[model samples]
Target: MAGDEDMKEGGLDWAAAYRRLDRLAAATDAAATTDPEQEREVMDERARRLARTVSARATPGHLLELVHFHAGEQDYALETRFVREVLRSSEQRVTLPGAPEQLRGVVLLHGEVLAVVELSPLFGRPAPTHHGPVLVVGQGRAELGLRADRVEEVLSVSRDALLPPPPALGAQERTLVAGLTREGIIVLEGEALLRDGRLFFDLSEERVS
Candidate 1:
């Protein structure tokens, strides 16, 4: 009986030792599988590849800064390279149906019938009576005119100066506005302004007539 009890105790000790050995083996395997040096190598290779791709895609071009005017306020900036032309307000004239309410009329800019949109009413403000210059932005196949109260001087701003737009801007402004800068937010929706046919001049034909 004494011998049997000793054997049973020994058996338990062996079983416990085996369990400890198994746990240690599992820990060693996990450590090997998650080697930090291997992970670092993979991350380094991925970063190098990404940097190469970005460097290859980069191109050189002339950068231009444009001041976007709206209502009585000067709100945003645009890249002048994107601007097709600038016209006098008197040169643009209002036309009949097929134009949007926000669209004052179509202007013949560069031999293209460009829709001229009033910026004030689109921003929920009254259209200013102020005579200013019209900026003709080239769209896909056509161009759109944005009538501003005035055309400020073209500035040469660095790309770093351009920042993201403010969170406080409303939905319409958000859609139209791009990022902000020390000057103000930049407008990136010149294409959107032209494509959105719903924007028409506030004046009716009868009223103008």
Candidate 2:
């Protein structure tokens, strides 16, 4: 039930906490010193060490590596293997007139016209008007530029910490969601997402308005 503030208040810094028993050993070495102040210091240090040890051991372990970013109001992540590169989405993109609304347009990247997909709609959220950056995902012809509201940081997630999508999610959003992270990040099934959407196939042949 304790929060981060509680841990900080108790001096539960990991490194210091893990070294709790070490101070006990040090106290033994200084056993010959009869100075009351020195003895009191050692006892206080021992208490701090005990607190840290309890805190560290109680913390659960759940870690997975992912490239995280923001889209709409939610946070999302893709495994590093599926990430090709990340570029600014502010650069003008050539809009595909007849493509699905999810397909924002195509952006030129490294001399290649990369099809950009707006994930907000696919996740059942309203499309964001302001673009942040292009998260280049997948590889080869399956590569895509995903429009992110903001690119956060690469995270290490714990498999056990992932939660199932809420039952209230629409089928489309559920299909794209791998699971919800303990920290609330949406872990996406990158390969399944791209395969299911098939964003690039027949993109050159725009639909007639």
Candidate 3:
């Protein structure tokens, strides 16, 4: 019985020793497979990790303003703050017989006549009816009305969110888009729309004899 007990203890000790040797052999094989190229790859991965950590801690500087709107099937946004008021669909008086093809007609707002332009037509899309709300935009020395399907909402976005304009935009669209945002492209040049003769009636200049 004593001999049998000693043999059992010896077997247990051998099993533990075999497990330790197996673990050591696996570790040795892994170390042997790590060549110079693998070591460089590991170092490069560590450098990239450090770079990302440092960049995340850096400070960002700049702010952006965003104005949201909708055009046709797509939604859009502008950065200009010239928007004064948003008016629902109103009666427009088609008085001008000769006007630009894009010009829909004229509308009276608060005792003043304002030319209403279809925003979709300017973007190379099918023109929308002047039956919707008029986005009243106040430019440097003029107030113009822009007809839109729906005036969604206005929001202020940061500069980091503004993206560069795509190269596919037409000349007119290029002139209108200031920057791209998550909401849409910001119409930085909306004032130019007011400058168009078809969309504005200059009241500042009078006939001089």
Candidate 4:
């Protein structure tokens, strides 16, 4: 939070990126063609374009755009580049058997099974009364829906504003933190959170026993 005093209300830049994503997403889902081959080709091109657009969104000028939210009583944020969307509800969340405590459950999203991660155990905080918004993040198998209490707003802050996490936090908890704001909001490194082996479980039949 060192340089966070300059944090201006964000709506234009981040919202515009989301608008572009919405248009591209609608285009893919609404692609219509009499020929199946033509439709495939069109979809492929749009996907490639979207990939490029996504890569271009990486912190420009060391200015990080973050999606701020609450999980229980703690405040947290993740870089906007990794956030795909926010779902108000995790409908039909199917609880898994014999899974790690942090592996909350799974939900069918966009025709794929997305794992819903329980953030409490990860942060060493107690579980919330119930799940709230789901922040859809990451790519393919590594993707997850982070259960949250409420989403605040997107804000742009310079990377320099982040301070190293307090020394007393455990190694596991410290690994996920990119930095902490002076006000105590934990800004997490998106890729580190996704790559955590604990979040992705291989629930084979035997493993589920």
Provide the TM-score for each candidate, comma-separated.
0.53, 0.62, 0.56, 0.68
Question: Each candidate: RMSD to true structure?
Answer: 30.0, 21.9, 32.3, 14.3
Error of 2 at 30 (Å): 74
Please tell me which model should have the higher TM-score, number 1 or number 2: 2
The residue ranges of model 2 lying beyond 4 angstroms of the native Cα positions read 1-63, 97-99, 140-142, 205-209
lDDT of 3 by residue, 101-162 (tens): 45554555544556666666556677654366766676433277666667676555666576
**Every candidate's lDDT:** 0.52, 0.64, 0.53, 0.69
* Rank order (by lDDT, best first): 4, 2, 3, 1
Answer with 1 or 3, whichever has the higher lDDT. 3
Show model 1 residue runs off by greater than 4 Å: 1-64, 67-71, 89-92, 95-101, 110-112, 140-142, 200-209
Strongest candidate by lDDT:
4
lDDT of 1 by residue, 1-209 (tens): 01121123212222332233345456545764789887577567657744643343312233435545544465655555445555654433433333344655445443334556777665656666545677766533335677776666555655556676677667867777655667564555554655555663333223221
Put down candidate 4 lDDT per residue, 94-201, tens digits, no spaces. Answer: 544334677666665555556778777887787775768888888533388898999998878788999998797899889899898777889988878988987776
Alpha carbon lDDT of residue 150, candidate 4?
93
List the lowest-lDDT window of 10 residues for candidate 1. Answer: 1-10
Query: Considering TM-score, where higher is better, how would the candidates rank from best to worst?
Result: 4, 2, 3, 1
What clash pairs does model 4 have? Answer: none
Candidate 3 Cα misplacement greater than 4 A, ranges: 1-65, 92-99, 140-142, 196-209
For lDDT, candidate 3 versus 4, the one ahead is 4
> What is candidate 2's lDDT per residue for 1-209, written digit by digit as tens?
11242123333333332233234344544672757787788577657744643332312235556879989898898876567656654544544333466766565554455677887776667877666788777644437888888888877777777899878888867887879987888898776777765455443323211
